[model samples]
Target: MKKYLKNYIWVILFVIFSIGSYFIGFKPGLVIYSNFNEFFLEMISFIPFLFIIIGLFDVWVPKEALEKHIGKESGVKGIFLVILLAMLQAGPLYGAFPVAYILCKKGASVRNIFIYLGAFSSMKLPMLGIEIGYLGIKFTVLRTLIALPLFILVGYMMEKIVGSNFKVEEVKT
Candidate 1:
């Protein structure tokens, strides 16, 4: 009960502020109320979709399969594995959380996970397709070619430097 209350404290505060604002004839506060309500509703609406996809991924993909292909010991194959995983990833950057959690538990290398997510966030198929559509193949390819090494370097630095200090319980960013 305490945990639940703590988790929902913001929601409670928002409701109180909203009701108080509405009764006090505060127009700006009402604008905030409406905006917060719309954002909250939209966020809530995606929960089911996120759960369905995560659950399916958990059920379909085996731990051994991921470990063999994307494990810490995969050597040079890890790069290809990360790219493949990134290519197959779905949703926006935040959507990687569920898969990341699963992969972490399943012996996926933290280093590879970093690279894969970096690639997913930057060079996702959907993003690439959109870029190609808006710009040109040359631009898309050039952008990707440039971004690839940067993302890889970022991933490596994240692993060697940031990983040492990071706590698994809270989000880093």
Candidate 2:
């Protein structure tokens, strides 16, 4: 019970907040309810499919295959591969979490996982296309050019700070 409460403290707080919002006024409560409903709908529509896909990937893709391309010793090729995978992926940032966990378990380096996550957060291909449509080709290209290198740099820096040999141990939840 203590562990469950510890893990879900924020959720409990959110429920309290929602109740307080209702007591304060119907409008505030409705707004919160509507937002949560929309988010829940989106998660149901998208996240389950992503989870299924990741599950299949975990089952079918050999760990050795992942390590060959994104392992600690894979060097520049690994970096490029991670970036490519990240850009191609479509969905919310939260969707990448499970994928990253799988990759870590499959022997992908900490640096590469960080790079993959950075690219997922910043350079998703569909979002990039939308950005180009609204922000123009030059702005989108410039941002991508700038952000990619920066993300790589951040990944390397994090790896150094955390320890060059660090790898994620399997986290049993």
Candidate achieving the largest lDDT: 2
lDDT of 1 by residue, 62-159 (tens): 63454457766776688777766676556798888766666665566667777778888878765666566557799999999998888878867887
> Which tens-of-lDDT digit does each residue in 54-148 have in candidate 2?
55655664644444588778899999988877876778997888888888877788899889999999897767766665577899999999999
Clashing pairs in 1: none
Error in Å for residue 36 of model 2:
22
Point out where model 1 deviates above 4 Å: 1-67, 164-173
Off by over 4 Å in 2: 1-68, 165-173
